[model samples]
Target: MSQVRPGARRVLGATAVESPVIQPRLRTIPEATVARLAVYLRVLAGFADGGRTTVSSGELASAAGVNPAGLRKDLSHLGSCGVRGVGYDVRALRERIARVLGAEQSRACVLVGLGNLGTALADYAGFGSRGFRFTGLFDAAPDRVGQRIGGLPVQPMTELEATVTGTGVSIGVIATPAEVAQQICDRLTAAGVRSILNFAPMTLTAPAGVDVRQVDLSVELQVLAFLGQQRAVPAGEVPA
Candidate 1:
């Protein structure tokens, strides 16, 4: 006589379900590596477009403004190693890096200001080539609202939520003045945007899991001026 197994008994004459397979979690890549991967991808794209099939680490690093060893180490995180005698396959490496960086997918982004800087960002063609599509443009000014930029209508602040939800936008850009940048950032975060590119001069605070990057042209200029001043100072001479 055959014996029935425990916990394997039939329920309503149906056999017991098998357990689902457990998959291993993916390793977390360093943020620096991620940034370099984007650089590498861009360089590889240029090579591929120019009909180049392979790239040595030294050549790629030089183009990417990074050291060869560091570039190789970063690529190694993605399990890519160049052949012993040959360099990396440009097309293959580009595809791999694109996958790693999620650049293979187009992400919808919304710009929240239509001022001079905002207008320039909206009109930029590079974002599209890099897989970021602008789905909405917004401005608080009445005169700016209803105007069109880069074929996208300048929407009012009132329509921000609707635009974000309707277009499934995940990234937000805040190019408004410092006074209103925080307000815009709050609205964007509440509307389900997780990544923000802030062009305003002030820093923004967001809850955990949200990413905010600030780009201040004035600050950059100030940094350059400081460097210039250092270079101009005579060696071993103290300035009053």
Candidate 2:
């Protein structure tokens, strides 16, 4: 049985296609552990690309920024066992983790709003290596439409639904402004986009079962500013 949201199913060309859903293990795995597992996958891919075949638990944990015990615990959720001395087979472990994270197959995505940030995101080529492909680019402005970025011509927002439905685009990346972000989000959900990566500065409301992840650049910068301020505190600053 597919765990993917049914709304993500779409008719692409002459065939009805669906995104490769995460395996059943997702339901049993803790969300925090799942996140760490993805980090571990990236670390393993780096090792594999460098021609490494095997990895010790300590080395893998260090590269992934986790302790050995915690790394073992996370993999344990996947029923993956590390050899007593040999640690784990790098290639095998990566495959196991990718299966659970839904990274084994490329997921189609569409981007709305082709301003500076949106244009930059569309032009990034690194998404292909990580199992994501942007199949459609869109903007509400007429001037932006017909302009090409990253090899795909920007289309008008009027074409958003047909494109998403035809491409089986399961995820949407919204980089529009605050005032119109919710409207864009609503349109994406209505088009059968099950997950969204919102770079807009404001929050968005969506129908039930739609997953929305908000990435606010200014707020993140503010958090880092707070941390930097704390680091600059003088000694003997224990006063309340």
Candidate 3:
């Protein structure tokens, strides 16, 4: 008798028999839903911290700036069937969302470029509660090296690889100038950083399996300005 491959159907003469070890279907969550899940997590966290025990979907949706129906659909992806009248349990829902976003596990992060924006981001208080902790800081400037910010001393670029490797860091933050951003990104990727949050104004390329998220302040400001104009001036009308 021929051996049957796991998760595959095997032909036995005219009868097809499925292998005993069946492969489970991959439950792919939509990219948009993933983004919204972060928003929901943030809102749920706030609710939990505020001592709220239960929240209606409408309340959570309003707080998250999403429609109630859409919010329910997003929560459905988590396999949580919320009660019809009572809505969701605040702490329970928060924990569920956090697990899905991997927020329960502490992720060590390394940030390069200790300029103004970089320094401020390093000092941000919100990261700790969200399961992210910056274990290392790197800068190319000699003056920045050995300087301490947010309880971590800044290291020269030479220390990046060693520090990342030592800390088991998989996430990196780049706040360098546009010209040097790609160089720093390349170094981080080479050092085993798989996910990057880029604050530099330019785009940085990475090899397959690496994820890069860009934060362009000017673009966001311009978009907000455009929306503000739309409120002041009716559609299709230009301001004099």
The best candidate in terms of TM-score: 1
lDDT of 2 by residue, 189-219 (tens): 9889989989888778899988887777777
| Stretches of candidate 2 exceeding 4 Å from the true structure | 1-27, 234-240
Candidate 2 accuracy as lDDT: 0.83
Candidate 3 error regions (>4 Å): 1-26, 229-240
Clashing pairs in 1: none
C-alpha TM-score for every candidate: 0.85, 0.83, 0.85
Q: How does residue 205 of candidate 1 score in lDDT?
A: 94
Q: Residue-wise lDDT of candidate 1 within 86-173, one digit each (tens)? A: 9998888888888877888999999988889999999999899888999999999999998989999998999999999899998999
Give the Å shift of residue 141 in candidate 1: 1.4
How close to the true structure is residue 216 of candidate 2, measured as C-alpha lDDT?
A: 76
Candidate 1 versus the native: TM-score? 0.85
Candidate with best lDDT: 3
Compared with the true structure, what per-residue lDDT tens digits does model 3 show for residues 1-240?
011111123221213243546823225566677778888888887898899999999999999888999999888877865887788998888888888888999999999999999999899988877899999999989999999999999998998999999999989999999999999999999999999989898877899988787778787777778878888776665648
Model 1 gets an lDDT of: 0.83
Winner of 1 and 3 under TM-score: 1
